[model samples]
Target: MAGVNDQRDDRALRADCGSCFGLCCVALPFSASADFAIDKDAGKPCSNLQTDFRCGIHTRLRQSGFPGCTVYDCFGAGQKVSQVTFGGTDWRQAPETASQMFAVFPVVRRLHELLRYLTEALTLHPARALHGELRRLLEETERLTGLGPDALEKLDVATHRQDVNVLLLRTSELVRAEASGTMKDGRKKDRKKDRRGADLVGARLRGADLRGADLRGAYLIAADLTGADLRLADLIGADLRDANLAGADLTGSIFLTQPQLNAAKGDLSTRVPPGLTRPAHWS
Candidate 1:
């Protein structure tokens, strides 16, 4: 379960735009849709971005047709690169640094995400057996994030992610198995084997009994998950855009990020994992 320690660690994983160099506004691309007002190419600055790296439409992103911006987070990678990787030099001041900073931003973001998961894995009581390995990997991942731009860009992030996922999958099993416990027949039947990557987009799943479900990479966009019992579910890479989660019990849910919550629809009755904050818009 999420706790005070997790919330404390979350401070470092959150975006501090004031310390960033507007990387997300330039490093990522977006299409013209309900989320964005224009088609922006990677490395190109958004028109709404200010000289100070703040969004001009910050307070009204959704109202100004850049709703996607509201859900986007660099997981503190923007500041780490801008302030540490590039040594506090603004890309505008050092035109030559722009390309590399933009390139390294995404790489570090991926590493930080892995770090986030590793940190959480170490906190799982059921995964205590794996805590030593998790701590070592967490240290290793932290070290990798501090490497120079050239080293970072050249790093085989996918291979490292595979290695991390191997441990994470095991950690997930340990945690879920404890949550699952033994059924009357002396077997664990709480988990379903085929829920990973399920195409449940827009499916009516209100009030479903989904405890301990392996929902990795599930396309749950626009699904009606209202009042669903999602305790101990694995939600990594789940697309929750517009999914109704009002009154849903998500306590003990794994790998559900803030960006996912931002994209989903929920109410005050929604029970999130302890470390996550309820989206202000939910009010």
Candidate 2:
């Protein structure tokens, strides 16, 4: 969402909470569950949202029965929707724009998520063959993020997501085959390790060698991965909630997002990508 008429980088994709207008606290809805203690309707500000548009429980969200808040990320969409889209005019400043802003924020958030993945895809050496198309899609997605609110609300995001998913699938094939020893003598194996959309909740996978595994959309919630090797694994859309990664190796995992890691359990012995930071709770 930060690619306005210039070159963009990872910094643009990282959320700067200070530059936001508490859009996540007000624009999104939540129901009482393990993730939240109370139910909240969309378009209403959370009780913890301060007058300055900051979360009052910022430092103690997990203790306040709001662990979901800590895991959720707007991927810099909040600042872009608040500053760039509305030109620094928050929903409170101009109440008339509140509905439109709230409606458009989610749309832009999805687009920004796509942009993040596209940006990451362009960095993969194995995906160099598809860099031209990836770059084209990235630029186009960035351009879409800069569109007006009306256009954004009316955007066919699903169709665009389908296009991106197609390319990502192909990119995964190239990278995984090269790193996982699944390709031999110009012949590709059937990928016996494929676990796309698998349900492995609470399963034991300790010390498993999962290098370059296709784990897209896998349900790994509460699974054990202690001392496991997950290098070069495809983790996009994987539900890693409460998964244990103590002493696991994820040095080259592909498409592993911050939110997924934030929801998981890990220790200092766990090795992640260079660009990612270990969660404070993963002591």
TM-score for all models, in order of appearance: 0.94, 0.93
Error of 2 at 145 (Å): 0.2
* Per-candidate clashes, comma-separated: 0, 0
List where candidate 1 sits over 4 angstroms from the true fold: 1-8, 181-190
Model 1 clash pairs are: none
User: What is the lDDT of every predicted structure here?
Assistant: 0.88, 0.88
Model 1 agreement with the true structure over 171-203: per-residue lDDT tens digits: 888877755667677766655544889999999
- Candidate 1, poorest ten consecutive residues by summed lDDT: 1-10
| Cα-lDDT of candidate 1 | 0.88
Error (Å) of candidate 2 at residue 217 is 0.4
TM-score winner: 1
